[model samples]
Target: YSSGPPPLLALRLFCGAGDSENLLLGGARARVSRRPKAMASAHPSQGLPSGMDPSMVDEYASQSKLLQEFVKIPSIGKAWVFTSKDENASRAMVSVSQSDLLANKKRSFLLNTHISKSSSKSVSFQWSPFPVEMSGVSAVVPSPSGKKLLLVRNAEDDDSPTKLEIWGPCQLENEIHVARSVHGSLYADGWFEGISWNQEETLIAYVAEEPPQPKPEFNDSGYKKEGSSQKDFRSWKGQGDIEDSWGETYSNKRIPALFVANISSGEVRALKGIPRSLSAGQVIWAPSSSYSLVFVAWSDDNGFQETPRKLGIKYCYNRPCALYAAADPFKEEADKPSTDSNKGDTAALVKLTADLSSAFFPRFSPDGKYLVFISAKSAVDSGAHNATNSMHKIDWPTDGKLEGSLSVSDVVPTVMSPQDGCFPGMYCSGLLRFPWLSDGRTMILSSAWGSKEVILSINVAR
Candidate 1:
């Protein structure tokens, strides 16, 4: 409205309670009417700018009405499907959001539904009567057993502490407030974000911004001595050193680091042993009794010639990263020191995908026999922003003993150029946390296929 062109009108049809396939097919036969000339003659009372096209005003009004209708329909966000004790019954929790233009924010809520299948292969979804709004919530994650829910309410201001609420089936169980001195906001942004609950559900590991670095304290008397915390009204802090962050959307963001929270004791500990030159994210508890953490680490030397330059990582799959495994900090502290000369190699951080240039979204198979992950080696090697992804698997030791070097097998190789009607390789932006099917060997994933994105059932054993 401020002298710019009208917003592009995007019309989307949503089939709420009907056969969506037939409705979509019927759309092909539907027709749209053209703009009538009479619409150009607008009401005189509605004052408009000189030389402005009257038809544009009418068109804008019409489009605005359609937008209002569309805005009423909330868009689906994250969803989780859980199987119940009864084999025929299953439940699903779907998060949806609608834009509240008046408030200049989004209103989020959860839709509960019951899914059932008949003998005739017919499926039905019984949705709840109303959705429960989740106000002031940044992220919601359900535990593996679906018995507990983790709600993250990131701090809105520097003074406010970030709140982590552990909600049980019937009530709020535990709430922990993390101060800025421990860490900044948790990374809710999809790229570097990784929130994972341990198998026991007693601990959670996630990625968060490191605590604020110390600044140089100064006063009217010039630079103050370091470590002097004397209260002086005239004393001010100076920018100590400027650090390079992942470019683009990561402006003014602190370096990402790993942290684990004990749900029972409400104790949060920042993980150590990772090199300062690397940034960690997408953390998950490894399939081990000790609960070792597996995560993706991006080295600071991501630029050409191995220089310490951080390129824009958002949507840039070419960034160099690799999977790493490190022992749990609490477990390491509790265990006695080993006298074995090889103990250092066993306890230290181990690179899981040292042979690959890029690896992420690590997931362990249901049987805990293999660790599968998607690789962007094609994008990394060719220096492309993105390319066809390849799936790889590592044979995990049954004894939970990680070796220095593990064998990696290629499950799906990159397809350079596919033929007509053939698969155009896997173009997956992200992988689900639990992608395995009932067979444990079959994995369900969504990948881009030409103009459409299609769900694929891949047999990892093949």
Candidate 2:
């Protein structure tokens, strides 16, 4: 192993199936052990290099302590974040490391990485002050082996002064505009609500919306909210006078599409199928990398509009959400044995239409052959669990392990609830890492509840 300052590190392992409570693995099945931190002693007197001064040694020691304060790192593959409901500027970071990178492997959720979203200040790593902004780490995802870090930040758009900025291994200091999406209007633009990084973190998936550019003639393209148009702005009496005023006509497309970008080649493209104009919120990136699957759920009308008329309560019958899977031609690292080998082929396509009434949480199994989603809207399952919600599995085409439904009477609430302090107010907004642990058959699911909130994970082995 190359010895030097750590380029990056993680604190969590992938997911799988099992169960847990105050216990981590399977409620009672999981066990815990403690190991000690490493020691670097060559005898204090023998330490200093020939030319270094004794005073310099003391100075260096003090600096090291300061760096540890801000450069704290978690284990690889098993970290998550949780946040609030309404968009806010507060959040907490939680992580679980498996102990030694190589050794007894004391795996556990040992530390909490909490930070204020608005902490945009100067920081130093060793001898440099790495300037940082606390705008918010919209999403966090661990690479398959937990070797790389993929983080998305909120940035200023090309047109406006605010948008999403993505940073990580591919380009450490530079930020790229991988996706564009709209919210309600100019002022109501949507941030990232859903994100899923392929197990390897080579691919990035997120949900964003871009307000529709209205038609010039009868388009009402730059339609103003209520009477707050250019003509009415003159009459308005206060600030936020333009918060959500710029809206496209109702009939205009407002759905956000699935955006996938190859972090390396600087390639950015919107997923196929979605109307670039419609508003698509909450896009989830599936774990499998061969095929890109993102789910976009939308409303027939303005989803945020609370008014019954705006909600079309009388006319609207139900919610419309669909799953779109785009297969890329990239081959698995294993498939490419030699550098001279040709690139891989495109992934086979499969589209799933999930039942809407239940608000199912669809999760793909570690093998990527099947999908597991909640079947019931809600239930009371005794012993702390209110009910047994339905759990479903779709067979992986090759193994055909898919099952119609699985009973959940035995599943515990703590396993499904907030593992590392993701209370109600702080719901999971996105996943920092997918299931990890077993060689490949099992992994952890890291989910976020809200803003830069706290994300937690539960261990599951299928």
Candidate 3:
């Protein structure tokens, strides 16, 4: 809860810019006070969207005092907030600019009300009721440092597509006002089709679909027909029709190219030389170390040739979105690593892939010694460990082609309901590496059930 000075605060609203497709300035004022209750009616019936009458929103003060004035901008969206602390009260409202976000404009404002008696607490939804507009920001992600907000916005024009923008450390908590961006100055090109943020918030990856192309006849590398085991690969259907090779007939659904960027330096570049599909699983940064990895899975004709009669899903790729890793070397390492073949290249942790059933949510142990992953095995055996563990190391091909050197540790059976891989034990997500652990080999993992993760020892050094 927070309280602010003055018994009055009001702001001005203005008309929308001509560039805005929807040119109407939407404004609002929010307040906290006491008033008589009115007979309630359903919102649509009351001719009020939420059955909330702005009039009944008690104006503890006779008039809405002018507080924060926002003017002639594309009226984005708006929201309201009311707060109470030490029996004192106040209100807040905010509106975001669509033109601002679409154009990569960095405009935002935050207000702080030092509620009396109390100061710190989880900032809940009830604290403020101001409507803020940012719908054009199809996706938003906060930087690992909490100092910047990344926004992916679609082009305002009908024909143009989406782009990427960054809102710097302008938004400060505790009511610090947000700084706005300059119109038309915001942009990172290419149609930003998808996005996923790493846990550290330092690296970012997105998929950009290229223009469509014609498909050619292929009877060579990937497809073969067998009487007993031949099955459809494109669609998971046991027997499905295959379409002809036409550019427009088939959509421009090419495998999405992935790119990683360093938030600290504004450096962005694409990860090349990896076999990936647009619908692949996510790319992530190693939690304990600073490296980017994208994982994808593909099978040879021998692997996916057979399919059961009964089917309920699509393409039969048992494991998709396999994790792949890449970490650009730092300056010092680039300048001074062994060029010898025998000593081995420890400087650049060559990308390593793990061979198992299927894995997701792969994370490195705090000490960067072991990787913990939830790998998928088969359903028939219903066993505790990966049925097939093929570990190997390969010389990374210079052509950007990945050579498998995937490795895996023995699986630890579930503490409860061993049939299921997931355990009912008080140990799960929000896992943290606490400094207080007696042995560095052990780290703490959190269980959302009831308690935070406590130190637990593990035999990692072995």
Candidate 4:
């Protein structure tokens, strides 16, 4: 393995998947399809797994169609590309969804490698010798240490429970099962996915649907409360009043809540005091010394309007959100005096971004000197679901003394539209939590720089 500092790396771009079965790869065109049907499913998860089928690899090896097909899927749906914080391994994991609606199930392929190549003309991927197929995976995230991977299998059957599996390089290390009473389906979509691992690697924070509210049980006599006995066949139940979850994408779902899981003991603790009026997502661990959690909270706050309305947040950044930090629940319990029967309330939750109208992805520098994030204020102000973005940074307090006084500074100003040939403005849906290089100053972010989503290297130190 190369012992030098990792170079400024970039991603390989591919032509969009099309109706034809032939794929143009590295200047060589390969007709790998047998039918007139579309080469691959539009969604990445539904697309063929990375790497040509081993049987076909021998015959089509001449074409070297490594990532030509792998990179072409239209919607990567919660894709994750991450590298380890420690230098022990110089590789990274790229997880792509292959969700199949017909099967009503989701799966993913894990390709491990270091993306150190950038080409101006062609797409390339030094894919791991082969991809590991993870079946029925709802979400996947890599730990900061890169030594562990978290794979989530959401309950597909209403009665089934959610399963969280922690895997090391060789085999499964631990597993945790969360009951439906504790939470419902996880928020795996890009906008609501908040899964994160703390610096210590022992705890994981994520966003999931809160436990559903109980429906009213009706008997032959009348409607009954919780204390009432079970209904018999003679008693038919009436439909309960429907609860709307902020409209649009969240139909029949409850509000999203923040939860922390202890990997070793398989315990989950919900952070208390998050108002039901607000929804939380895109959570990341703060510098362990400063705070336990940092997440974006969207509130139902309206100013001067006749009726208060909840903005549709799915794929929409225009909904106003600000970063907030809170202490880990377990830590708070430990700090309390053991003898004190009355435990104090959860640590005070602090709002870190009072000035930013839309700030989400939170990435702390490798050295922990700065907290960098991307803003979609332009989209928020323009009322568009998607638009150009801005990058900003905050000088983190050395003593971990955080307050609302933290000021946001621009690193990359908003670019509405890009001029010819130059890089198009930022269009990142979200960023990898530890998207930093070894230098601690430069970060690698993927944005819709142009017709294609391009990887960019930004030097915040400048």
Q: Which candidate should be chosen as best, given lDDT against the real structure? A: 1
Assess candidate 3 and give its lDDT.
Answer: 0.38
Report clashes for each candidate as comma-separated counts. 0, 80, 41, 4
The residue-by-residue lDDT of candidate 1 on 252-282, one tens digit each, is 7899999999988999988876776898999
Tell me the tens digit of each residue's lDDT in model 4 across 101-162. 45755556777666553445443456679777877788788786678989999998779888
lDDT of 3 by residue, 314-378 (tens): 22223322445654323223344476532223433343544444444444444444555443334
Task: List lDDT for all candidates, in order.
Answer: 0.85, 0.39, 0.38, 0.73
Query: Candidate 4 — which pairs collide?
Result: 45-97, 45-98, 45-99, 46-98
- Off-target runs (Cα >4 Å) in candidate 3 are 1-126, 154-159, 171-203, 208-211, 214-253, 262-268, 276-279, 287-291, 294-321, 328-353, 365-367, 380-407, 410-462
TM-scores for all predictions: 0.86, 0.41, 0.40, 0.71
Model 1 regions lying over 4 Å from their true place? 1-46, 49-59, 289-291, 336-347, 417-421
Cand. 4 TM to true fold: 0.71
Sort the candidates on lDDT, descending order: 1, 4, 2, 3
Task: Rate residue 175 of model 3 by lDDT.
Answer: 15
What tens digits encode model 2's per-residue C-alpha lDDT throughout 1-462?
223222211111222322421224435444333222233343343566753444466667777766555344545533344334533322333434433433544433423333333346543222113223222354445444434555555445445422334454355633555333333212122322455566555666665445334422212344345533355332423232112211333333234445555666655544544443233444554543444464544333333322222232112222233343444323333455687344333233344444422223456656665554433223212211122233334443453322343222211132345446434321222232334344543434333343343434443334
Model 4 whole-model lDDT (C-alpha atoms): 0.73
Q: How far does residue 270 in candidate 2 sit from its true spot (Å)?
A: 0.9
Error of 4 at 378 (Å): 2.6
